[model samples]
Target: MPLIEIKHEGLHKYRVIKGNDQYVVEQKARVQLQQWDEMWNKKQEAERKKIEREKAAIEKVQKKAMAEQQTQDAIDELEMIDNTLIYTLEIDDRIDWDSLKDLSDFKDPKPIAPNKPLYSSEPQKESYKPKYKLWDKILPSIKQKKIDESMKVYEEALDIWKNETEKINSKYEKEVDEFKERLKNWEEEKESFEREQKEKNDAIEKRKEQYLSGESESIIDYCDMVLSNSNYPDYFPQEFDIDYNSQNKTLIVEYILPDISDLPTLKGVKYIATKDEYKESYLSETVVKKMYDKLLYDITLRTIHELYEADAISAIDSIVFNGWVNTLNKATGKKQDICILSIQTNKEEFLEINLKLVDSKSCFKNFKGIGSSKLFSLTPIAPILKINREDSRFVDAYNVTGKVDEDTNLAAMDWQDFEHLIRELFEKEFNTSGGEVKITRASKDGGVDAVAFDPDPIRGGKIVIQAKRYTNVVGVSAVRDLYGTVMNEGATKGILVSTADFGPDAYNFAKDKPLTLLNGNNLLHLLHKHGHKAKIDLKEAKLIMKEK
Candidate 1:
């Protein structure tokens, strides 16, 4: 029977009223659902924020402790130097002036021990004599006594000077020995420190190189390798995608969820005490729906948990999970894959969740997930736009290197690579045009680069395509040649693509005809729109061409 709304309000009211004297069921159901939603919705926002705050605080504390430990290690190594040599310069008074200057200049020091103190004689002291200059000549005995006394005073002063000089020299030599020992130890420690730091830095650099060179395979490949050997429930298709955003240090996983039909409907078997027998009964639809919703939630959480746990490198700080399903579309009566839920969660945030006790649906809502209106509905789910990946492996064509001159740029991609890239591009484009694009043989194919076979009866036939890795702006001649090739081959259309922009005449010529001209920018945009990235510089390409 076709269902239709009653045209009259009175009739509709009557129909709902006696609609089995169960008119209150729908309204009561709505009230119950509303109560359940309210129970979770009005939760204090501060409670959710506490989780983030705690994680940040813990990370901050750990980092601070690590920095402190490094600082202490360095300080301990430096403290091994002689404290007095470091704190005082007492050796300055003992060093030879000549050698002292050289030592300060970082040159070899040949300090010589002195038998006497280093002093300059400014003037001789004059002594008061009792007019004895001539008297001493007349009196030989007095003159002899005066000479002996003068010798005695001189010897006494020399003895004192020698002792002081010896002591100073002895201390200078000791200080020199101590300084050398400390310097040797310090140099050794410094070298060790630098070597250790270099080793650490080299390890990090190796990892970085592996990351960029696709050797590490990023988290996506890592998880795939791990999960491929992982044990799981039977008939569970572990179809998923892993994309790492280097900028954000995040791993986005698009997991294909199983259909609700696969979920267990019976919660548990119960005993009928009255009859003393066990009753095997199926769960109510509402209970089954709740269990299924929770199962999906559990699966999402489990996936994130597995990735985080298996990742020893912790390359990904957080994961964005997109759980998708294939549901039948009423319009086309075909099953279409669509994402039913999306969640962005950090490791700390997810590990804190207790799946067994928490209301899975409410928790999913708290974590900000988008799903279908009803958990068990047959309606199709829309995918989250941000998590979608743009397949751009084709852009790698411009990055080809090796066996080519260093002066060459993007345009220097070997002719074979250029031809392959063009074939892939036109194949994608012509696929929409109802044609199969095939590249001609490398040697000679009647001056044709490629040909597209379109099966559509109207506006569909063989389309000739030519790829020009030109550094200079393509002139009208290339466009004219493509058109001639199309006509010669009895094709329906023609396209000429170049790495450089097309000249005005070239565009104008193709504008009025069945031929199409794709310049460098147009080609790039087409590649990017279809999830490819490429780099092209006309001036650089031109310079490289000139060099070649």
Candidate 2:
């Protein structure tokens, strides 16, 4: 059963409240109720607006869908009509050749020509002229007159021949006399020429005797005396050591000099000699050797100049190598190594000499070496170093630490420069495409030594890079760690760089993964590919690593 509820009544004394206070309480309560009602109305209005907006959005989507469907339906109906037309055309194959034939021309027709002559005709006649008097008709009388004239002419010719014979005899006698005089003059001239030649031979023989007997202090002195007597003072002293057993007498003077550097001016000197001596001199060993050396030097210089002229710097080493080899071949009785060394030294000297040749010209300016040695050393790092400093990612990677070795401190400095150069090359080749690169020293624990970002804008995302400057082979574990990092970072690719070669397992593991491994040889190739050269040798690098 439901419990019965009892109502309690208040005392009548409590009903004595102020009239204004009751009205104020009632008004305050009414205001609160009105506020709540206004709030509710606002909420309802907002909800209604939201519903209307949703309905409008749905209508917009529906209209767009309907428009798209209408376009598709139009396309489909057009396609169906086209198919029906094609079917109807395909079924209609009947021909109407009878209708196409012309009714006016059904029979073969004959060819007719206009009535006219093919050619104009007229009576033909030859235009001819006849001679009145032929030579045979007039010759009989003329022959007699000619015979009489011939007899007279023969008599005159005989008289003239007798006179002419006497005059020709006299003229022949005078010519013979003149010829004899000319012969005598020629004989005198010949004697003079012979005497002069004999004197020249005597002088050359004396000079030769003086050279052979060591009477002259030096061959150069004799040559200078000989040349000083003539116009040219800068004559090449003959090399007299070589003996030639020729029918004609030959004078050979040996000029002793340390090197061929001073041979330029000497090469231009001319010598005046008798024909016989000149012919005999060609067979002399001294002449042959001098000519051969001069020729060789000239050819080598020409080839080198041609290569330089063609702007072929890569061929310089090959030129040097071939030049050294040829020089060694010519250097008989000399030590091979010494000859090679001399050739190398001479090559360097030749470079300067060539420069001097150009420098002699008034318009030519002085040229420096362009630091080829330094550039060559840095070549192996060029591919790794970005030419544009702004594009280099590892520009701040390795700081210039303090000197490593005092004795080879320059080498240490070079190494530092090379390190920076390598970093620059890597930045250019690997990170120039708006990719990010981070370089840091490997921690004691040996995780990732460096990280690089390779972004693919079209596909979206970045790649990870790990560089290791190890002297030994990079192991598989490093590659594995890089792969893991790549996976963790959600990268599309990974790269591992090492100064040394990569281990077999490293490559095998990276084969399937989107990983690129650059080892020592590859690194060198890349450097060379981009015009970077390795200044330090492998042995030197190994030694430095060992020392470290």
Candidate 3:
């Protein structure tokens, strides 16, 4: 007989002599293996279902227990209420008995008995009477005693009321203390329940881990076997060296590439190398220069975008500060200016670059000059400008006279001279139409400063003016006060002139509130409109509102 072997999906058999019996044995072994696999799967499924049913039963029991606890809490609250009502009733009963005692003392006939003997012998003689008649003297004393007794009774009633109130308060305090203690105990019990639940969950998790351990062990074995025979390169790059030549001040990087040729190249990988200078060790200038050059060359070799993606560049301006001269050339050079290239990325980016480099210098210089003392000196001053010649908006020219020293000479400003400049400017800008202008001092008595009433009959109306010389932020409160003054003075429109800039909040408050806020800048513009240069820039004032 020749050697023979028979193989099946689940079993194998070998025979030294060739025979058909080996094939039949292998087939029977395959059927037994299939049955074993089916039985193992069914056992695992039944175990999972049992665990789920047990968890549902535990949850249902917990819910029932919580419901019972709530019911018990309600019954306890009702008992507490009943005890409080009983205490109140007992206090009321004691008060009633005290009131009855006070009434009995008033109605008693014993005090009248001593007076009766004197009245019974009154007919005997006038000489027999006591020095003071008992009826007259004793009756007054008795009446006074009754009054005093009544007051004492009233005081006793008040005392009882106070005591009862205190007793009720004490009861409430005791109840509150008990409630707090109960709450603390309830919280502790709830925590204990939670801890027990967590322990149970942990136990279930441990059981699941044990149940899965065999399958996990088999899968790990299979994975190890597959990986050992798999065709893949496991080699990777380990280290790299950056070398700099001192003689020529040149930089060179020697990096080991991965042995796997299929991987892509890493272009912007950062390599940080440190060179320490100790007190005992001295480095030559040539070495220092070489190191500086190496740092610059490495930093400049890669663009900002590549360095950013690779996380190689730390601070955005690190290249600029480390290698100042090379970075400047690269930034401003015609052929390879990385700064301009960075700018070409976007318009907003270009603006930011310009602002950081050039415009910020002036602002920084200004800020540095404005130290602690001089920071607040730039107070805004708003000068009232008028519209024309013969304008009644200002104080009367003849009434606004001044004395020249002690001499008998009078100095005055005519309305024509004051109004001529304003009228000419208004004519050039607007039209030759004239307007009546009125100027008056603003009063705390609800009156405006300057009211410019148009001369045109069809459009003539009042324009209220309020000039504020403030060193702080003009708030909404001031605007509200001005609006009230305008409404009271019967003015249709209002103008608020301030020497300082309005805070954004103040500006928002004034919107559509029938008021126009003219700050230092606006005041200057108005002056310029009237053909007069503003003597001040009120916008530079140290206003109360500083941007956060």
- Local distance difference test values of all predictions, in order: 0.60, 0.41, 0.38
Candidate 3 to truth, TM = 0.22
TM-scores, all candidates, are 0.34, 0.25, 0.22
The lDDT, on a scale of 0 to 1, for candidate 2 is 0.41
lDDT of 2 at 150: 60
Clashes of each: 1, 20, 7
The TM-score obtained by model 2 is 0.25
lDDT of 2 by residue, 1-548 (tens): 21222221321111211234656655655555566567667877999999998987776666556555655554554344223212222221221223322233213232232332233222122211222245535776665565566666666666666676667667766767776777676666665555544533453454445445543122323323332222111322221111111222222211121123222211121222322111111124454345334332332333333332322122122222112211122437542211111011123334455333332211111211111122111111111111121322333565322222223322223433435444455556655556555554434544444455443334323445565656567888888777665554334577776667788978866775578998766766676666644432446666866787
Misplaced by over 4 Å in model 1 are: 1-216, 264-284, 378-385, 391-393, 396-414, 417-548
| Candidate 3 residue-wise lDDT, 1-548, digit = tens | 23344333322433233435767556655565566567666877888999988986675566555545645554454343223212222221111112222122212222111121111111223332234455647688766665566666666666666676777667767767776777676666665555444533453344334323423222222222222222222332222222222232222222222211212222122111222111122235454343333222222222212222221111122111111111223335632111110011211232233221232223223322111221111111221111122322256422111211222111121223323322233333333435544555324543455565543324333456666655456787777666655544334467777656678867765665567887756755665565455333233333222331
TM-score winner, 1 or 3 = 1
lDDT of 1 by residue, 69-139 (tens): 64555344323211212222211221121321212222334343334335433222243122358879899
Instruction: Give residue 103's lDDT in candidate 1 (0 to 100).
Output: 21
After superposition on all C-alphas, the RMSD of every candidate to the true structure, in Å, is: 36.2, 50.5, 39.8
